[model samples]
Target: MRLVIAQCTVDYVGRLTAHLPSARRLLLVKADGSVSIHADDRAYKPLNWMSPPCWTTENTEGPTPVWVVENKAGEQLRITLEDVEHDSVHELGVDPGLVKDGVEAHLQVLLAEHVELLGVGYTLVRREYMTAIGPVDLLCRDEQGRSVAVEVKRRGEIDGVEQLTRYLDLLNRDSLIAPVSGIFAAQQIKPQARTLATDRGIRCVTLDYDQMRGLDSDEYRLF
Candidate 1:
């Protein structure tokens, strides 16, 4: 199945009923003879349309939300729950692990660039920091005597900010370093997470895959 964002428009009924800012129009074309329009980004509600036999809905319980349906000619259609609530790009069926890998790889490049851009001396303490809570992506120290912990996420996984915050708290309590700082790096951040980071004065950086892979090594003097 291939999911594409066709366009975005003001959904008056959705705006009035659900109050979402804009309704993103999505087109899902399957290798089979099934095609669908996902609206409102929610999966709990059954899909009811004017055309009978053209669509039928079925709900099922599992690790992820599952909606099974059949088309006019009895073609099977499966809509995972995450598809409606979260961006389909982040769905399990999608390349979520690949996205995470891409984000982490990009973060490594950004860390090197940040040190050069700010003209500050820094050292990477650990690339992947393992802890009781979980693995923190990057741990570094800056010239200004500050310990920095960075957590990175891809475009779809902006929820990493909270996880980074928790790691920051742990680092402050467990490490000898004073005035520990946190960095949240991602391809994109959710509005709520971005607002929270700004309010807390956390350093946030956004990096796309291309930016990560294209770091200029010769421009920076490495100590």
Candidate 2:
């Protein structure tokens, strides 16, 4: 990875056009062959970028250093560096990606082990129960053997209820689980989400991360 901090102006000519006026900004030339320009404030989002497969040509004969990056589609990003403060390259060999702890994933495992957390006599049918649309967090059978499709979230919102509704609508179509019901389980459920779940006849259960994980507390502690 190559990092360059400079006083630069950028222009993007592609599906739509954009301009970033002269400012001190970061330019990233990644090993993946992608190039991106970033301002100081926008966190991870780049001010402008040209994704690979792309190529760049640099010109120094002009008054300022100019770099034009072009992709196969002929989309172009033009960067002019008036003054370079720093330029260096480093090898960030590989990333292990995100490893979440005490997230929805952990909650799912806790709930699955203690299926009773959901209901009395509830038995887990499977985790990540697949449907045509997508996989459900947990599929269980209540004491009466009625199938229950559960959607798990660290924070349950109206959107999570809506997601479960879609799964229920699809799961109920299958004769084998035609009478499937839904449970919206979360560590913290907003009142609006609870109301939406109730209106849709979906049960909402608040998970106790402490009790589940032996966490007297976790990252997102809810009362």
Candidate 3:
């Protein structure tokens, strides 16, 4: 990644803006060795750079230090208090697919363990299995000959309900499996969606981040 510098401005009242000029400039450098100056406030927050220590140190009547130098290999760039205002900007430009892949991986492990813990006689049929409907995350069969479709969403938003609903619809339409039941698992669930799901008799479960991360070794047996 190449280093470049760009300019930015701050309007929001926060730790980074308490000392610097409200309308100061910021320098932004792209990884591809390109530089652009942005006067817009929205463009700065996503940069993922920490606010310079000068703002905090100066506020306490400490020494007014010089600019901070961040060295990457042989390249060095000096970042001032004003430049650190946009540290989170880089995350905004990340690939959405990479985020999805990570969420899916975590969900796969959790779902497997959850099934075993329930002591339900179920068989893990497929993972990330492609069907006429789409790519179903996990497809399993309970001992009672009922097909269970599980979809995992990391963020646990209400949107996951709609997604699972679609999968259910596809399963019914395609006649993929008989007596199908769907489970939508996430870290959290929207209140309204939870009510709606309950009313509709939909099986929506909430699994926290820690629970997903703590699956036992036997959980990997499905893989």
Top lDDT: which candidate number? 2
Give every collision pair in model 2: none
Per-residue accuracy of model 1 over 118-170 as CA lDDT, tens digit each: 23576677777765456677777877757788776765243566567656766
Ordering by lDDT: 2, 1, 3
Cα lDDT, model 2, residue 212: 71
TM-score of 2: 0.52
lDDT of 3 by residue, 35-102 (tens): 32344476333433322111211132334222332323222223334333343335234322323667
Looking at model 1, report the run of 10 residues with the lowest lDDT sum. Answer: 11-20
Q: Model 3, 158: alpha-carbon shift in Å?
A: 2.3
Which candidate achieves the best TM-score against the true structure?
Answer: 2
Candidate 1 Cα deviation (angstroms), residue 18: 25
**Per-residue lDDT of 87 in model 3:** 37
> Whole-model lDDT, candidate 2?
0.84
> Cα RMSDs of all predictions?
14.4, 11.6, 16.7
Q: Candidate 1: global Cα-lDDT?
A: 0.54
